[model samples]
Target: MAHTQKLEMLERDDYLRFRLPEALKERFKLYCYLKGITMSDTVREMIEEVLKNEDLEKLLQEKLLQEKQRENSRDETDD
Candidate 1:
């Protein structure tokens, strides 16, 4: 007799849930299945990639400074 792989049904207690549109969720599920990957692995890799994006951080900081400058200008106008 050959050995069979047992399917694991227990969810990870440490896992987090993210909400997505139904169509997009289905597409992502199928994509991961075809790529022989779990959703967790794909999301983890994407998170790591975004966290490593220095340009994104710089852009966000620039936007934050612009917002603060605008707020200061508004306060000056009101004074």
Candidate 2:
């Protein structure tokens, strides 16, 4: 088995802390353990996924607009 290095502790100025309900915290801890990832990493991945989805949505909208413009141009040329 490969040895794991200890994660660096967060400094007071380097991180923000939030309180979760006790029940939620317990559930989150269990979920994190089952997934074999730190809670922080799970949260970070979730946030990244959300941001990526938003960017994808914007790109899809732009492509749809371009397709509409092309169709309009074709219609004008045919008329």
Candidate 3:
């Protein structure tokens, strides 16, 4: 019963795909291999770490506000 529930939860998880430079990719692969961890697990842990960081959220919000201000400035110049 527990095994079936675990499988169901995993099935519901989303798949993420992205690209990286070849050298960076190779280095990450080697790091994971040396640590005896799967690349996906390592990436997931890193993502969780970032999500837990309060400063990251604040930084993202600041970046978004700056972008909106830039767009508004451009619109004003065009008018």
Candidate 4:
């Protein structure tokens, strides 16, 4: 005898909807399915990644400035 797995049904109206190009929608759905995540979750993750990348870029710029200052100090000390 095989056991059946029970699945929960999410209410459609409870979620937001939007329209996209057919090709883009299909590709996004396929990617989401492969990652075992819902399309909404995938979109949310993408937005988070963009925000995190912006923060990382700002930090990198600060570090670069600090490195340049250190190089200038070393040059003055050598002179």
Where in model 2 is the C-alpha error above 4 Å?
1-14, 55-79
Candidates in order, TM-scores: namely 0.62, 0.48, 0.65, 0.43
**lDDT for every model?**
0.85, 0.83, 0.93, 0.81
Candidates ranked by lDDT, best first?
3, 1, 2, 4
Residue-level lDDT tens digits of model 2 in 26-76: 999999999899988888889779887787878899999999999999999
In terms of TM-score, which candidate is strongest?
A: 3
Task: List candidate 3 segments past 4 Å from native.
Answer: 1-11, 55-64
Tens-place lDDT per residue, model 4, 50-70, is: 887687878899999999999
* Model 1 lDDT per residue over 1-79, tens place: 3233222334333667878999999999999999999998999899889888768878999999999999999999999
User: How far does residue 25 in candidate 4 sit from its true spot (Å)?
Assistant: 0.4
Per-model tally of clashing residue pairs: 0, 0, 0, 0
The better-scoring model by lDDT among 3 and 4 is 3
What TM-score would candidate 1 get against the native?
0.62
